[model samples]
Target: MEAPGGPGAPPMWGPGRKMGFGAALGSRSKGWYTVADGNLSEVFFPFLDHVALHELRFFVSAAGAPPVDDSGDGQHSISWISPGVPAFRVETTHHEYRLTKDFFSDPEENAVLIAATFTPELPDLRLYMQASAHWEPGTDGNFGSVIDTHPPALLLQQQDIWICVVGPFSRANVGYFRSSDVHIDLTDADGHLTYTYDRAGPGNVSAGAEIGIRAGAFQLAIGFAHSRADAEEVARTALQKGAGAVRQAFERAWRAQPEIPPALGKVSGDDGMLARASFAFLHCLEDKSHAGAFIAAPAAPWGETNHDGNHVYHLVWPRDLCRIATALLDAGDSDAALRAFRHLQSQQRTDGGWHQNWTLDGTPHWQSTELDQIALPILLAWRLGVAGCLDHDPYPIMVRPAAQFIIREGPLTTLDRWEDAGGLSPSTLAACIAALIVAAEFAHDAGEHVAANHLRAVADYWNDRVEAWCSLPSGQYIRLGSDPDRRPTEGSTAPEFLELVRYGLRRPKDDRVLRSLQGVDTSLKVSLPAGPSWRRYAGDTYGEQSRLAGTDRRAGPALLFDGTSCGRAGANT
Candidate 1:
């Protein structure tokens, strides 16, 4: 049930796509991103700046044997074709090269160091430099000024930030080379500094400063800052401590993470690897410095092959966050669960419901015109309470208002989880009912009997109408309280039925529950690659057109219910 798709429009591309080693480091402030491959892929502080400078991967060429590809597609071709090692080391029979990149975060700034070890048979280690401000799909973000200062330092500006590439390498062709031309041909240079811009090429236009090493082993420290002073300072420090030390520190942080508790069971073999990777994915998607908000995925690939396609997922949906919270609590990481819950608490709308989605910074993004969003936070808060992760007084200011909104709007025509506005979705009703019952329990725990009774009554009222609200006139269960037709059934509603049972609103043998399961299993239960995944509803447009059909790109053939149905699946007899 491992669904590996996000950030990269294709399963084959994007920083997050091939990530498995969990060796990547992110800034606490989330101002920077550096993968183990030595590419400073993301720098989004003052502005969103992304570039790939690995084109100059310390390749060695004979005196006249032509420098490595100055073409912009070199890195892309390498990433797409060469493949990245899970750990971080590259080798060949003649040239055995070991490269390790690690980034460490500090209150002052985040710095990255790349340590390389290679054989000395080759002459000078040619350096390559191509940088750009934009992604790979459009106009190549041109190269900026390459200012070389005394004591061996070069400041290159791309997009908004100043990148300082400073090291004590024995030699550099462009140890100090400045180019006013936005499009300098790479082949003309001696592998010192080349900022090649190929707008017509299949990959992005970027420029990087390549370093040539006569000695087999050397360290390069790359530092990023909005201003030149900061970049130089950090770059100087990085040049001093080297990449090895940063990698060691980063490894320490990775090890510091509490072990996954045994309660998660014997998560081993293929499933174990998948589970570990999924957990790593969640950690990879989050920004540790800024309130620990999680992005849907890294924002690198959109500007690459996906074009602007990957912008939508870099968000923190409360619904999605709830899934993360559940995982954390189950893993015995109550502290993480609490932080996520508090983050959710921060997003509750003034009206007691929540926005459909939000940025990791807590800014509201796209939302639905439905009740489920409101139901999600309440459900999380209640669960946190059960997990003993709730920090404050039970059922704070947001809880009661949310419960009341469900009481008032639970049965009304609204948006379903899929963002369609019309009828109440069975999932929406079930979520609302769960929220109310839990709210009542929390209120009772707090000795607020009156509030508890009122919430219980609302739960009961909604429990009775849950079927009626989601039923079609044809006597078949509709995807929502109101649906145009019942032909394409919903698999989502099956587990919502179980939520009703868990909330004590229905019996496991309830006829409606059985019928809802039967309806979806009969129609919507198409076999996905992993297993049987239900369409959100019939005629679902998601992954509707296959790439093989030469139509719109489809992200799926994936099941919508990996984490979606776990709790509800518990009610299955």
Candidate 2:
């Protein structure tokens, strides 16, 4: 019988959202894996943009009881195996049993290894491994098969790309997702994978295996390659090397970099928060095929029910890249920051403005152009140039055109930093004014004094006129728009107003800036028990909302799993 969704249809957003990820050093690894709700989730291969495996989760059940997925039915927790590396140790607990998995990427191959241990050694306990494969960026139109090898493996393929799941299995089977998968049947009736199939179609497909946990432990590896044989070989070799050896190499590789300062090693309430942030940031740069092309996040935001399209956040934003470069500079990773600058140079459009976002290979994914993206790179060049990180000047090729692009088509942005609403924006203007001023410094270094003078002149003009262009009659900055008098009837406040002070166009203690902050806090602040947090804006609609009374989607009064806009509410940071 076909499943309720459809026969071999695409999978839903998540077993759960990504909690953390594990990737080896950028120089040695091409594979990255994420831990979500304590389950191995979203294995990316070759490139961070391509998701080869949707999930590889462990299930355990007594002989006649239904299986409990590590993701959904267990209490989950995760932590890095080391402070400096992205490798993770995830633990999930239940009344019946407990599972602990140490996840690490194989440094020498495109593969990930997990060493797992189950607790209490129950005699009737059976451990099953199930892998849902996507095989490409979007999770659709994939094929799966069971390979009868010595140790046995499951292979998923999409055109030329292949991914193999290698491990010790007493028996293996392949099946269509949800409808006829052995994993589902195991959960539905008995705790055994009895309804085994040999192959699944060119739709949502997965593979299942009954793994024998000897003394409460087992090992598995997920590997990727252009050919099926090579993929299996890579995984087999990784598993043969053992997770202990592979994990040591992974941690040692990351620790080879400069040590993080003791102050940054831990935070007061959230120990390891800063260190984990650094590791997560560096994880995005681990793509060997595209050095320094870091995606914003290795996640699929709002992915719970929205799985049909390729709207994941695993793409590069030049604005985010520039900020990351600045942070890298602060963290003493000059090499990574410089590499990012070079990658930005490669992605710069002929018109000099970058697309709103792009894939790691310099392919434009979204066609919109944000002025902040055009300006931020020039700012980065100036920072890098000032720090002597740039061996050669960037004026002629990068900074010059980028500065000119801003002058030609901006301080008025086609899209704001949020990729919403056009026209005058406080933050966009701040970026343009700052970028032109820095670009002027590069222009002078390049012996183009006239260009330098003109750039500074434009920056000064924007700096002086920003208040007139953005402030409402009451002195608060409007979230967006060209005219100050045309403020929206509903109150509006954005964190974007702080950019004027951040970019040095305004003083922190200035009366106007303080008034704007007051307005923002009064309008957007949510006083939670933990602390005060601000919403994106007064009328932001980015998070969960109630379903409308009659329509499939719209603003309404009842909260629903569907993220369709129901009403404006605080989706805080």
Candidate 3:
């Protein structure tokens, strides 16, 4: 979903469903859902109440059933689900029962349309909704409801955004009752409402409203507003415009997305579906806010740690962001790339180091002294600027410090990308060498010829150091230069040689490069479903703890998906 205004605007759909953050619509601010106890979460106008889109459902009677029944028959089964158009489809093979529910939100600000198109049309269909506020203390807590007295039953979140649940308003059969209460009198009075936390409400009953949907199509539109009256007005307009118009409006709004950044237009058939889904999942992972960067996963941002007592991937990792940004650029979207660049720039340390991950506000967390984080950004920015993916300069503050830091840390002992507090590794030095060339070019473009020369000279020296110390007589490479203990021809060393060639640091036929690749293939390679996998390092005591010496321990012989020979997917990582 595009922002309320137009194209060139940020998309709103996010990883709401994947993360179970109650963010089904995945709006940067507006959409959220609940997965607790199989209950539909609340979607709140984020700017208004700490409300969520929580209460939403569809009730259909196949053949015959009450419009307000409490239970569902197996007859109402969904035959298909789609991420894009046609949204969700329900069909019954035994009879002529079929209906498709299309759920989508507005192009501007906030609004969600849960529309249904029926085949063999059921005139007694009901669009069930609760005018429930997730917030407590009612209006003071940025929550309120507009029920029976309005054009459509509506729920408001502090007047900021309102959920206008549209239904057949002319029907007087609707009344407000407790959501969970077994016995309660129905209130058809001027004012009636309910509140339920989509996450943790047991007896959380909601006073709801229902609209009788006519034959062809119907909708329950959740709209954003700043006041109760405005919400009521939006409900009025939506009722008048109807579900068909709302769907059409949204279609027009989202029409250009598949064309921009991705177009995925070139791929056809199942390949296209997979490609689109991949792009959509990545986009869903995005926070969609102007200041937000693409987070690593479904987890919410800003947390220092996850449930397992380790750092969460939900926050931005500079190295990870650089790679993600490059992919976006490759896919023809420089906006995400540029944003990733800016976000990483904001996290660079004064000493030219980066934290392992960072929150949205740029706060450092899980600090790791990895060299790539320092070097990768410099390379990414320079590449983007040169490739024309970057519209603005990212080097005025990035190149020099990165070059200096890599120079300072290249020959020193530092944590490897594997997070081990081991001494210097060749891959770290190799990556720095690549980044240095980019930085030198950036320096040259800025008229800093002397600094450029110094960077180039240092890069050459590091390249020489790597070749001199890490090379073994077996035509293979090692991780540390000074010691051979705990060394078994590291699988991680295999890529350094290839990288050296890619960045112009080494010749393709260079003996050391050939030796390393040949050695890794012969020593670290293992069979995998797709192809071969490599171990983190030779003598890699990955899963078991005791590698040096222990009677009760054994090294893991697992193959990881990250192209490593460790067991499972992330044994060494």
lDDT of each: 0.50, 0.75, 0.50
> Which prediction has the highest lDDT against the true structure?
2
Model 1 misplaced stretches (Cα beyond 4 Å): 1-40, 43-109, 115-129, 134-143, 149-160, 166-205, 211-220, 265-289, 300-310, 394-396, 412-414, 420-422, 446-448, 471-478, 483-537, 543-573
Q: TM-score of predicted model 2? A: 0.90
Residue 517 Cα positional deviation in candidate 2, in Å, after optimal superposition: 1.7
Query: Model 1 reaches what TM-score against the true structure?
Result: 0.67
Candidate order by TM-score, decreasing, is 2, 1, 3
Q: Of the candidates numbered 1 and 3, which has the greater TM-score value? A: 1
TM-score, cand. 3: 0.58
Q: Give residue 108's error in model 1 in angstroms.
A: 7.9
In model 1, which range of ten residues has the least summed lDDT?
Answer: 1-10
lDDT of 2 by residue, 282-376 (tens): 64553578888888877766554456446677888898788888888767778888988999999988888788888988888898878988999
Candidate that beats the other on TM-score, 2 or 3, i.e. the better one: 2
Per-model TM-score, in order, reads: 0.67, 0.90, 0.58
Write model 3 residue lDDT over 1-573, tens digit each, in one string: 101111111111111222122223334235433221112334434421234443454333332333322112224343214433223234322133344554445544356555665454444343344434433222222233336554436443533444545565432222122322111212222112122211112112233444444456666666556666665566556656665665565455434454434345455555455554455445544555534366665432111111121333556777767777777676676776787787777778887777877665666667767787788899888768877876666666767887788788665446766666556566667778888888889889889999989989988777766655566656566665654243334334444455567667678898877777787677667777887677666655433222322121110111112222243222222
